[model samples]
Target: MSFIYSISANTVSRRVILSKFFKQKRLYSSKRAIILGIETSCDDTGCAVVDTEGNILGEALHSQHLIHLNNGGIIPPIAQDLHRKNIENVVNAAVKLANLSFNDIDAIATTVKPELPSILFKKFESMYI
Candidate 1:
């Protein structure tokens, strides 16, 4: 006499995968956060708006390459001065492109550390206004 044991394999159901996908989508949909990123640590003044889902809504950047090249080098005072003048326009353009107003932004992020000269830091701080 011979006897054989039956074996079975279990497969993941489609509903399980779909349920997980919808759960993830719900988590992402529950809230919206937009970040305005400003980078003024160097000769390039840049601004970007991004959402929590890793989408860039808008961006604007202005480079001081030509100005500094004409001067043969970056003059600290001139770079800081130029940033002061261009930051407003850059931020405004980015906001408009993103189709958002200042009030709609959840937060503003800027490079404010690794302190530069006192005057330069002050100039960067002024952009917050």
Candidate 2:
């Protein structure tokens, strides 16, 4: 089994610099928000950074399809271990691709629910704030 991670809106902060310098409802407000999305529901691990306007700033992904296929299907423990090992690299690549650091991200969003294991869900949950 390959570990899966999902995107969530936890790492972003809503901070709009409302100043008189350039008023009149900016198209993409500073408060528009930037989100880092991570998805790991099955054999693919994906991460993306997007703005509130639905613009993708950066994205990274890793697929374990070949690994699983060679094994004749995913083994839960194997999948979980793979996810654990690859998540950090995936996330780091996303940040680099976005040309931003963790502080620049407004939030982090990951899928957490019936689709993912509770332990994996909790791992992302702790990244909030």
Candidate 3:
């Protein structure tokens, strides 16, 4: 029942930077681990339960993409409010989709970066805590 939990956007951000910096052909490869992932770096409230095998057991996403696009990019407070509004439901759906629980998760990871507003952590707390 042991699995890893990551709040990391590392998959989406830093890895790309490092890959580009080092001129590495391959930045990373997924391993044999189960991960519960959350993303609120912007407008989308996304959650997923995935195994190291690239199998997504469950996933939920609250997309503000269209909204932002229509509104002409992100409005900070609106983004934060949307994330705060949907984070919990999104994560819960992902977990339920995976048919797993927190006790089954091994670790928790988060996406940390600069220039991004506070939506990430705020959504984090809004989700569970």
- Model 1 scores a TM of 0.67
- Give each model a TM-score: 0.67, 0.68, 0.62
Kindly report which residue stretches of model 2 are placed more than 4 angstroms away from their true locations once superposed: 1-30, 114-117, 124-129
lDDT of each residue in 1-129, candidate 1, tens digit only = 011122222421111011223334556777666767776666777889998799999999989999999999987778778877888888888888999987666655555432322343355445443
lDDT of each: 0.64, 0.65, 0.60
Question: Model 3 misses residue 23 by how many Å?
Answer: 31
**Residues 19-129, candidate 2, lDDT per residue (tens digit)?**
222233344556666677777666777889888799998999999999999999988777777776787788889889989887676556655533433455455445533
Candidate 1 global lDDT: 0.64
* Descending-lDDT candidate ranking: 2, 1, 3
Top-lDDT candidate index: 2
lDDT of 3 at 116: 49
Pairs that collide, model 1: none
lDDT by residue for model 3 (1-129), tens: 211232344444321111111222224533344566666666787877776567888899989999899889999777877777777788889889889886454334444443242455554544443
